[model samples]
Target: MPVQFIKDPNQVGDAINESNTKPVVIHYWNPLMGEESPFLSLFHDADENLGPNVSLYVVDSGFINPPHDPQELPLTALYVDGKEKQSVPFNVDQVRDLIFSAV
Candidate 1:
């Protein structure tokens, strides 16, 4: 499926728990980073080759209190079977590997 945007901060949990059989990728980004952030490109690159069975989501980190430090402007998490497996700073290769390896 295509990458989905998390509109409500309250619904972040729901987005992560939405699928059970496939890997779920949640990208948390600060809007303050603007469109020029290198992290934004990493998110976009992963989205382009995302598998159909993978559930992808984008969250505006500013809208939600993320577990990691806000200074970590962009974070990407991988969830397997409705539970978080790993979270890391935005990196194109790492993100891509996280998704495909899980599949």
Candidate 2:
């Protein structure tokens, strides 16, 4: 599963809407994430395991639209059926759990 890098909110919305076929796990991050970039590797680790049941979108900060705050550097949003299901802060186990659960 390739992690998508969305630019603006419109792209993000499109990605989330397309997720109607499968759950979407989008991570909104910025350069400030620094060492935390390695933390996101967990998603890649989970990628191949999830197969086609999930879609991963890793968007940069300032591209967050409604329901997501721009000030939040690293926010994770879970979308199902083209709707925002859950949003949370960056966390390793938590995000991995969210993806597995969606699967």
Candidate 3:
């Protein structure tokens, strides 16, 4: 399946819990901005490299009209597996690797 755009935190939690067998990539964003933001682009690129088994959950950051686009501002990527979580600066190659590894 492709990346899923989820707007609610409760839904995100449910989805994550339901998909414990699969790796989940939650693409958080400001709803008002739609997919025009840079984060979406990065997520899209990363999604292209992932296999069907990997799932995505788009969590809305609750910023309807963000002061600045994530693309314009620096962003980071987070990985969560069980209780372990790690975050790092967003990068093309790194994202690619993450997706590939998940698959």
Q: What does the lDDT read for residue 76 in candidate 1? A: 76
The regions of model 2 sitting more than 4 angstroms off are: none
Error of 1 at 78 (Å): 0.3
lDDT of each: 0.69, 0.76, 0.52
lDDT of 3 by residue, 1-103 (tens): 6566666556756665644666665544565665444566656666676656667555565421123355532333334453213333346566555555665
Q: How many backbone clashes does candidate 1 have?
A: 0
Where in model 1 is the C-alpha error above 4 Å? 36-50, 61-66
Error in Å for residue 31 of model 3: 4.7
Best by lDDT: 2
Tell me each candidate's RMSD, in Å, in order: 2.7, 1.9, 5.5
**TM-score, cand. 1:** 0.75
**Ranking according to lDDT, highest score first:** 2, 1, 3
Q: Order the candidates by TM-score, highest first.
A: 2, 1, 3
Winner on lDDT (1 vs 3) = 1
Q: Write the per-residue lDDT of candidate 1 for residues 4-100, one digit (tens) a residue.
A: 7775888787876765767787777777877433555545655677657677778874653356667775777887777778886767777667766
| Native-referenced Cα lDDT, model 2 | 0.76
Clashes (N, CA, C under 3 Å) per candidate: 0, 0, 0
* Superior candidate under TM-score, 1 versus 3: 1
Q: What is the Cα-based lDDT of residue 76 in candidate 3? A: 31
